[model samples]
Target: MLCLTGPTRAVTIDPPVLLAPMEGITDRIFRSLIAPHGGLGAAVSEFIRITVAPTPQRVCRRDLGPPIGVPVALQLMTPDDSHLAASVANAERAGAAWVDLNFGCPAPVVFSKCAGSALLAHPERIARIVATAAAATGLPVTAKMRAGISSPAHLRELVAAAAEAGAAAITLHARLRITSYDEPATWAWLAEARDALARCARPVPLIGNGGIETAADIVRMRAETGVDAVMVGRAALADPFIFRTAAGGPAPTVAEASAWALGYLDAIGSGSPKAKQLVRYWRCAGMLADPAQRQALLRGPTPAIAGFFTSLVPAGPAPPATRTSG
Candidate 1:
């Protein structure tokens, strides 16, 4: 287990691999659906914006979900610290294990609002926002950031600001905001940030994110950068069993994959547009091999698609150890 400790809070994140919070994805239902599959240390909520006013407590509770099984960290994004403390209090009451500040999102809308990665250009603002959240809640406060805005010139200051402001842990995405997602993440930057955090008075954990797609990548990242943990984002969309695979567990069989797809469909309800979109991303669907044939099945009505997934499952006893009680 990896423990992220700060002055007033400590969170034990087992497996040391987390699910990156993706906007428009990784919602409560998505998290619940993936939780049964093993290998997650924790799952982060998509950032809950605290803009002109504090987010209501019910919204925080819905975003955080019930604190069962995998611990969920509520992520917050804002241009300034205006409603940070109030939002943090709502998160605490909502049962968030920890809180994460967003400084890595590259969306133009968020950046235009002076939120998300826009804050990467202002290290002092990040410090103030983090400090506000830290003081408002006993829950461990963390920060997620990219290397910088246009360059890595102020990367050290960004890391130092969050750490000095009492952040329990910091996750570095290892790419400048101007860089495209297709560009290779700079592992050297992770190493640089690791070195910077080591110089902090408290030395909070550093989580390496971006461009990690396989179990081998996870191992290589830790060996190369000395990050305390790793976080997986888009990769999990393709392979829900990624965490288990990274932990050296057996890969899910075709039958197991079929079962999961079918279960996911059931959870989202039959004929859901969401299921159609997300199903296209699953590795199991890739089993179809032929693009034309795959599209034929994927585009069909929900019932037909469900039947196709069911056909993939050979008649047999159900898979074992698919879900953890926790």
Candidate 2:
């Protein structure tokens, strides 16, 4: 178990696998669906942008919902530190276990506004944001960041800034802002960040992210980067059982996968068009490899799509649909 020291208490994450925040993907409904599979130590909400005003408690509650299965860290992002502390307070009131600042998002919409990875170019601003959040609440304050915005020259400085500013833990995505997801993540940089954190007066845990897919990848990342934990994003969407499989657990049976898909459909509501789009990811990765089956799933009616998934299960009583929380 990995113990993260919060201001008021320590949070222990067994298995040490956290769900990384993905913009359109890791919403409340998705978090609930993934909870039953069992592999994560914690989960992070999608980056909630705090602009001119403090984020409302309603917004935080909508994103966080009621704590379902695991502690969910409320992640916030902003172009400046104006309302960061207030936002953190709102998150605390809304039931966040801890808080994480987003300095690693690479989307152009977020970057164009000087938030997310754009903050990577300004270590001072990152420090101020972390300091504001650390002062605002008793929750463990963490920062998620890339190596740098456009270059690696300021990597150590950025890491040092957050660490020195009182961040309890740091998650390194290990890719520069300019890099594409297709590019290989430089695990070597994660090692460098680890070394820099060790030099701090109070060395905190480091979480390594990016390019993690299979159980083997999780093993390799921990061995190579020496991070206290590992976070998976895209991989989790493709395979909800990733955390389970990483821990040497068996992959889901066809019926089990079908039940997972149906439960997710129920959570999103059968009418959502998104329900049709998500089936591609909701299935265990590569389970729908047949071209005909893939097309059938996409072209089928939304309500009837559940039947297609059910067909994949063997002849027997259907697996019970797992209940999902909003």
TM-score for each predicted model, relative to the true structure = 0.91, 0.91
Alpha-carbon runs more than 4 Å astray in model 2: 280-285, 291-296, 299-304, 315-326
> Per-residue CA lDDT of candidate 1, range 1-326, in tens?
67876457788999899999998678888788777777889999999888789988899898877655988999999999998889998988888888999999899999999999999988999999999989998789999999999999898889999999989999999899999988999989999999999998868889999898776788789999999999988778777777888888777787787888788778878867877676566664245557776688776776787887789788887678677686
**Cα lDDT over the full model 2:** 0.86
- Residue 25 displacement (Å), model 2: 0.9
Q: Considering summed lDDT, which 10 consecutive residues are worst modelled in model 1? A: 279-288
What lDDT tens digits, residue by residue, belong to model 2 across residues 1-326? 67777778567888898999998888988898887778778999999999879999899999998776788999999888788888999999999989999999889999999999999989999999999899999889999999998888988889999998989899999899999988988999999999999998878889999898777798899998898899998888777888888888898777787777777778888888867667655547457767677778788888888777777766877899999999
RMSD (CA, Å), candidate 1 to true, equals 4.9
Q: Could you tell me the C-alpha RMSD of candidate 2 in Å?
A: 4.5
Best by lDDT: 2
The backbone clash count of each candidate, in order, is: 1, 0
Number of clashing residue pairs, candidate 2: 0
